[model samples]
Structures are given as C-alpha cells and as structure tokens.
Target: SASETPGKAAVGEENIVKLQHVQDTREFFIEVLEYLPGGNLYQYLEQKEMLDEYTACRVSLRILKALDHLHARRLLHRDVRLQQFILAEPGDPESCKLADLWCLASLPRKKNFMVEEGRPCDLLTAAPEVVKQGEFSAKSDVWAAGCVIFELLHGHPPFGGTGKALVQRICCGEPEFSELGTATGGLSDNAIDLLRWMLQREPGQRPSVHECLKHAWFEGYNVEKPSKQVWQVEKLIRHVKLWGKPPHSRRNLPASNLLASKRGIVTPGFCTYMGATSVDIDFEPCQMCQGVLEVIGKSEEQQSLGSRVWYWVTKCVLSLWGREENPKQIQLKVCVKPGSPWVELGSCTLDDSTALEASIKIDKPIRYVRISLRGNLGGHFGIAVRKVAFYGYQVRQIPIALHLENLKFLRGSRLHTHAQDIHPKEVNARVHKSLQSSLRVGRRIEGTGAKYRVYEDICSGSPHITTAAETPRLKFPQGVVLIGAVLGLRYVSEVPSKESAPPRLRIQIVKEVNAGGDHERRMKKTLLFATEDLTPPSWKANEVLGNGYVDYPVMFSTGIRANGDDRLHLEILFQNFSGTAHVPADLGLSFFYVPELQSPSTSEDEGLWAGCIQSVQSATVESVSLGMRKLLSIWFPFHFPRSFPCDFLLLRFYILQPYILVSLT
Candidate 1:
C-alpha cells in the first residue's frame, strides 16, 4: 500500500518506507508490510480453470472475514478483486490473505473527490451504484467479492464490454451464469442464490459480511474457527459436483441457452426451473444472424422486465399468409407493464385476394406482446415481413412469429400452445378401433399446435433431441402461413382397466354444414389434421391415480381454415369401442380458428371506396335468411352519396327470420 502521506501508506508508520524527499513538491511512500506466501486466487484460477463451489464458498467466507475485519475497524477496501487476494498456496487454504489497501478509505468519499484522488476501484467489479452514482460502502466490497466469486465459478467476469461500454453494461445489466449446467456441472442453489444477492445493482440489497458467513452455501462448514473453515473448504471441493452429472455423450448437445437479452448475452435463468440441463436447445436466430435488424416474434415466453423499451412497433407486414377461401382474422396484444390483463392493441382481417396483406401499427410504447391467429397454412404458419418497425426509446425493425426457448424474452407463436411433460411407458390395454392397428414409434400424426420443452428423443429416451421440429410455415405467395398443433392433453377420467385399451386420438378440422342442418354429421375433407400418426407417448402422469394406472398428456399441432359461417363450424370426432370402453369422457379439443370466409366477389367490396371518404374500416353488407336446412337470400341497395355518414358496410344475417343481432370487429 502506498500513498502521498506516509501515515496512510502504513498505518502508525511501523512499515512506511520513506522513498523520496517529503515536501510540497510531491513525494512517494511504499509500505513494507509482513510477507506471506500464496499468489492471488486470480492467478490460481488461471492455472486450475475453476474451483469447486464448496471451495469457492470457503474462499468467499475467508474473504468475507477479511472484509469483516476491515469494516469492523471502519475501513473499506474499495477494490476487492481476485488479483488483490494473496494465497499462501492451494494446500494451505487458511493462508489466503487480502492485499492492497492503497485505495482503502475509513469512509466513503464524495464522487468528485474520489475522481480527483484517482481511486483504483476495478470498473468490472465495481458496484453498479458506484459506477452510476460514484458511491461505495460495505456493500461495495460485497459486490467486488461477488465478481471474484463469479470468476471463480465461471472463469470470467459476469459482464463484458470494454471501457465505456463495459462501464455502462456493469451499471445496467444483471449478473448471469451463461455457463450454468453442463459447464459448472450445476451450481449449488445456495451458491447461485448468494451470488445473485452479492451482485445486486442496489447496494442496499447486498448482504453484510456477517450475513455472508451465515449463507446456506457454508451449511456444513465451521465458520466459528478459521482453520475449520479452511479444512471444510478443501473437504467440500473434493466432493463438490453441485448438481447431477450430465452423461458425457449428452454434453455435446447444443447449449439450449438464450441468444440475446438486455440482461446478459445469455441469461441461464431458465435452467433452474426448466430442467434444461439434459436437453438440447436451438435458439431462434435473430437479426444478428442475417446481420439485418429484425423485429423478432419469439416462440419462447419472455419474463417481463423494464429493459428500456426500444420500439413502438407501429407496422407489421405479413406475407405467404394462409386461408385461401376467406380472409383470416388476426389479433395482437401487448403488455405495457408486467403481469396480468394484456391489452388488445390490434385485430384485423388478412386477405390476399385484393393484394392487401395484414398490417397495422399503434403509435405507442409497449413492453410485452402476443399474437393469436387462425388461418390456413399447408401445415405451417408461413409469415415473413417485408417490413416490421416499432417506435420506442428508438425506432427499430424486428422479426414476426419467431420461436425461441430459454429465459430470453417473450414472443408467442401459434406453435406455442405448449405440451405438458411426458415419459414413455408400455401397456396392454385394447385401444378403440381408431387405434386398433399397431402404432409406430417414429411416425408423426397431425393434431393441434403446441409449444415444447425439448429434451432427448422419446424413442431413445436419452439426453438428446431425437426428432427435429416440423416446419409449420415455409413460404407462400400470399403470406407466411402455418397450421396449428396441439400442445398437451389432460384426460379427466378413471384409468381404463388393464384389459381395456387407451383410445388413440387422431385430430383434423373440416368444413361442416349449418348447425341447424345436418348438425350431427361428420365432415370428410381435413383442413388442420393432415397426418396419420400421433405423438408417441413420452411421459406419464401417474401421480394422480395410483397403482397400475398412469395417465398422460399428449402434445400435438395442426393446420387451420376459417370457420366462415356461424352455423357451419368444425367438429372434432373419433370412433371407439374396444371392449365397449366409454369415450374420453368429456372429449374436448383445443384448436385455432379464423372468423368469416369471403368469396372473391364478396371481398371486392373492400376495394370500393366513395370518391371522398375520411376513413374506410372493413365494412361487410349482406343479408341472408335460413330455417330448417332451407336458405333464402335478399340483397339490399345502398344510397351511395357523399352524405352517407357511416364507416362500415352493413351486414344483416336473418337466421330463422326475426332474431336480430349486430356484431363488429
């Protein structure tokens, strides 16, 4: 430690080395303190790669003690980095000791004064508030310690960037362990939990030296005795494989981690709850891939955070879209803030017949967004934007209808109904006639759209993704289009008897006559379900009904078509009767739908406009009457004049004559 004042160099002047003429001209003093063995932990880590969490915790505890000693004496080591900690050597764990108090202060100095004094606080390990507000306290030391811990556990600092960029990132970003799981093997809940606390951006949230020692990470360690803690550190390091080990073969699976986020380059926050350790992840490639900025529609759900909203997303132009017979209805919602009750921002009909695609914009800022659409895709949700722009802190372009996994950000996809977890099993029950034939393992069947938590293949039941996701939407002349699929199935009934067979469910959507006419008949032409096989059984839900019975939730997805006429809807049906088993009890199917189908001639009205009109919203004017399978039509004449004050094209559907109803979108 050295300072302009000899006393500050070596308190009490016992080890102060007067190395120059001391006068107003200027002088330097070097402190000759006690000599101890051991280089800093930073250097040790360079050679060893990483330390076991237990050892890291012990080291952390020792460092905490050092801070406790300094803070107890009203001192603050503004810079507590790995390089500043001296190690007596790996064998002598207790030999670890703190170094460099040149920048130490009895109390926090003013921001202006600290700058003038040339404080040596390490910017990378600097407390966020210190970086943003030029402040430091006991908590600042904790933040520095957290940085050291992060390096010990992950081999690098939590944030990356150089100079000003580095400084800004540290001030705004949350610490993340991108190398969580397979790399660290798995971190101790206590270790990660404590690390999060230490790296808090708010200094007040950091724990005290006393609290650090009391952390769960030091559970089996003896903190009362310094020697005991050292012994425990070594003991824990010897056996620390914090989480379960990943099979060597499975280690090569893609790092199913986040690709980008304002939080960190890759946020591994999802690993803890997602059971992502053993699964392969293919993150959606962003504009970062094409090198062209895109307004991305992520398939993964994003956690709501206050990352400065960057775009208002005013316009979204979709192409290769679906629904050939009629215009598709699309709805978009955005969450301005986090949590419940999303706001519906836009809802419009997409029809390519008139060469006008689906595009809308809102001149406002939004935090989170979602889209629920029903259209006809040749088994895909084909959609790409010629242009997608949003205005926010800054206007930017992004992607539309993207699917991403991991704890990145939120973007919903029609392929996101989400499948419930499943495990494979063998049974001898007699399935209904629909599935009386042998079921194949590799074949796929069409059903409903669903989101999935990728893991090993169900056929092999290992830690690797077996089947690649089917292409829901490719490219279309109209706009991007994709059929939806089923995500999960929860059957609410008693398990079929051992001799009873589980019914096989094959799903598909088709055109139906008016409800009042031929209401009980099944249609033949499939619109959504276009496949023959089904999702092979993966996991079973047996926790509910005990014994030999195990229920399961099957995941599925399919194509879509507009259910134009209210009476003419789609019906989900299947055959049954293996030993006379009851139907799936309350058989219910969840599928996507688009409203109103317009013929080419009927849609032409959208293009007709009055010579001078203020605005033209979608207006449909028509009148039809139906009763007992009988249909009657009547055409109404319009008074087309400048003074015809109305926005919509009126439509009057007289179902069974007099029951009148009005509706608009």
Candidate 2:
C-alpha cells in the first residue's frame, strides 16, 4: 500500500520522519535522522500547560494523520506517546510529526494482534489489553493517541500514580471527567463526545483510526450559537490561518503584542499599529534592525497625514527602503513621550539610490519616532522598506595635563608630596564634571537612588569609585618619544565577600599639545588598559601596591607618542563598566623609566629595559626589510625577480669583486 525504500518509510508524507542514512558497525546500527529544532510535544505541553479546545483539536488531527500513515500498511507505532511527536517548527503546534519509529512492529500475518514479552512503553498511556496481557495491535496505538488528546485538552494524563496502583487503575478503573470543560477552555460537546468514544476501555468498542479521523469535531461541526458570536469565532480562526501561512503570503494579519527580538534584547518603546495602511513587523531581524517595521499603503488615501506609522527606537536610527517608481516624500517626527507635541526631524524626498540616515540628538529622553508617507506621482503601488536600524554612540573627553607614573621614582614620602602637589580634590571634581557632561542616562537610570539601576548587582554601602585619580605630570623632552609602560596592580578589598561586584580598571593615556594657550590646546587619548573583573592571585591587606602585585607590560612597535611640545596625562579610573560605581585597585609603575637609551645602574632594570629595546629594534628591522621586498616585487617587470635573497647575493658580488682585485694588484 506504501512506496517502499530498502529499510525506510516512503517519507513522501510530511507527517512521517525521514530516515537519512543507516550505518552498520556489526555490533549496532546507527540511524541518522532529520534534525528537528523543536523538541517534542511533551515539552511543548509542559511550556503551554494545556492547549485550548480549538488548538487541541488541530494538534489531535495531525497525530491521527501520523498514525494513519503507519496503520495503512500493517505497521504499528507501539510506543505512541506525547514524547514521540516532534515539532518541525518550534512553538508551532501544527508542525508536529511522528519521529520515533524504532519501536515499530508489524501485525501477525494471520491475526490482527501480536504478543510481546517485554513492556516497551510506560504504564500511563498503555492500552488496557497491553497491560492485562502482552497482546498489541493498531488498536493499542489508537488508545495511546486518545490519552494524548485528553492530556492536550486537560493539563494532565487521565491515569495518575505509578507501579501496581497505576496498573490496577488502567486495567479496571475509568478516567474522571471532572474539570474537562474548565481546564484549558470550554470544551465543545462534539469534543467531549469524541473523547468518550475513543476511551472506550475495550479495544473492540473503540473507533478505528480512520473512523476517528471522520469524526464531527474534525469536520468543523459545532453547536449552534448567536450569529454575532459565531462570526467572531470564524474571524478568530481566520486570523490564526493567516498567521500560520508563510511570511510573503500573509496580509493584513492583526497587530501583534511586542515580543523580544531574536537577539533576546527587547528594544525600548512599545510598537503600536496606526492608520488604515498595511504593515508587517519582522520579529527576527538578525543584524539589520532590532525590530524591522515595514508599512505599506495601497492607495493615495493611505498616503495621507491620517495614515502615519509610529514606532519607538533609541539613539541613532537609520530607516531605508527599496525605491518605488517616482520617489515618495516621507516626513519624520520625534517626541519625548506620547501626548507630547512631536518635533519635526526634517522631511526628505527619497529616490531609488538615496537612503535616509537621521541622528536624533537625545537632549532629553526620546521615547517615540513617527514616519508618515506623502507623495502624488506615478506608479502608486505603495512603499516597501528593506531595512531600519537604531543604535547609540559614546564620546570620550579631552585631557588638560600630561602625567607619567614611575613607582621606582615615587618612593616613601615622595609619593605623599606628589599626591598633594596634584590637588586631588580639584582633579576629582573636574573628572566628575566632565563624565556627567558626556555620559547620557537612560529612562531606567534617571529617578532618585537610580544609580543602582545601572549597577544592579552592586549592593548599598559598597565602595564608591567616584574619583579618577591622576599621577604626577612630566613634560616630554625634545625629540624624545614614549617607548612603553609597565604597571604593578593589586586587588584590595576590605570585604572578602563574593557578593560584591568585581573591580574594573580603566587606564587612560592622554596627550595634551600646546598646554600654554587655551585656544591651541588639543588632547588625544590612548586607552592603555580596560580590565573586565580580573581576580588577583591573592587579595592585598591594604591599598599599598606591594604584595599580591601582578605586572602588566604594554609595548608599541611603530610607536605613536608625545614629543617635547606635548604633555602626557595618565589617569587611572576604577569603576564597573556596567555601572558608574567604583571599587578600589592599587596601581603603581613597576619598572624604572628610561627617557633615553643608556646603560642601566642595576642588572634587574637592565634586563627589563634591554628586552624592551631588543623588541623595538627587531620590529624596526623586520619593517624595513618587508618594505624593500614589496618595492622590489612591484618594480620588477612582470614580477621576474621573485627572490630577494638571490638579488642581494648578486648585488654583493659586483661591489666586492672590484675591491678584491684592487687589493690583490
């Protein structure tokens, strides 16, 4: 009755699972099947609790189709249960298919049933005959399908408990029908009647799988109701049908409640559908947009001011679409909140090649952005948008002073005087002022005691990192450059509890040019290090940079540094990147500073300095040779001379041969 493959089913039917390959390793056989992203019906039921009568009927119809596929031929899915039905699409109930065919058994040639010695299925969904005796047939699977249907309509299985008590219940007891109508939704009389016929304890008394498929419930027969209520029910079913269709074919499907984007980040602002125009919201816009909002208008009336699409996005928003014939005029508007007057963000006429890129300067907190279409030209088939995106940007500040920290230079009382000389109070105040001016706060981080919103994990009474501590300043000498830096950092915590937020260190190297004049002064920053909560080997007892110190070396080959005209500023900031709250970290310059290449007084300083010089020299040599190789490769006609070593050897012979002859004569 079915198209046969060697050891697999026809699989032409969508309800049956496709067996891709069979591998025999003598000991065991491995059947590689199709990959299904959606887990199983059991897991789906656990998530959804119970399906509504309408949704349950749809699911039961598919289960019967899968059973009929196996039953048409003499095959029986002996272990039919909720776990066997795998969904082709995740979260879609109608995408279920019969996947587990390992326990498939054939009916006896002369008889309708076969006797099995072992129990392959659980006692809960097992048929009465299968539990009492070892006999199994197509009727046993049908009985299991009935249990699944009951569980779908109700939240739990008909039979409960385990072991001997469960066996006695299934063998002799009847399932309780209380809470059937009130569990998921009001169960239709047709649904109740179908359940009663399917769960007829005796195998012969139950309807066959084909007869169950022809039931009045699946045939869309419901009891007579008021005309208005009946129309509403039909409308609801129609809406579900439209949503179930493919994306391109779906049209005018009602507005959906905003769900989290595929990235799991729910973009700010509630999305509302307005006007009579047709629009589609793409929930999974991978890299293009957080939420891809598309609006389409069929007629000129739909393009009027009354037909506007309003959406909420934060930061810099880029909205673009494929050019329709005769460019459409689009007006963009923005407001801080709903009911607030909208500020016009400029209107533009767009062509096929032009794109709309608008940067909304978030002076206050912007909550909504509205886009309205207006145009009177040829080819009025509506506008189609290909992509829309919203993102934020950060701006760093300019430093006024130059600083270089050498812990070897700052020893004992010298450290105290240097700290006092910098005016810590003024520096801290300036740092705080500059940070507040640049950093923008979101709506969530604006209210009283709202600093914790940014640092949600950090608790009250934790160490506050409100200061951006500065090191002593030193001017660069004429023609001298900054080679690199070595830092000694140690973690210091009074509270040794894991509940506290981990410390983050941000070390900024700022260079200020022409510090004498306010007009000519320009600052450049180099972020030397930004650590992400790194744990030290051991915690230190105090704020001193002595014990439990770890050394960090930062080197640059093609060095970009400050000259004599510029002053270097080293600012060490300790704060959580997720929040502005600061923790304590001891930072000190580990190695001695060498302004020029000179012999070291101690072997320890010499080894570290020598290593730095060696690295810089090696980098310079490699860069010079690489440049020469590239020049030779391009200069040669048709790239004839490929090898640089052979060319060098030839050049050496010409110069040395003439000198050797003159010496010999």
Count of backbone clashes, every candidate in sequence: 64, 5
Worst 10 residues of 2 by lDDT: 656-665
Clashing pairs in 2: 402-568, 402-569, 403-568, 403-569, 465-582
Runs in model 2 with CA error above 4 Å?
1-7, 24-26, 181-185, 221-665
- What does candidate 1 score in Cα RMSD to the true structure? 27.0
lDDT of 1 by residue, 163-278 (tens): 77778788776664633432223465777888888888877777887788788778853333222110100000111111113222212221222122221132221121122122
Angstrom error of the Cα, residue 360, model 2: value is 62
- TM-score between model 2 and native: 0.34
TM per candidate: 0.33, 0.34
Q: Name the top lDDT candidate.
A: 2
Predicted candidate 2 versus true structure: per-residue lDDT over 106-146, tens digit per residue? 67688889888576677778999998887798888888899
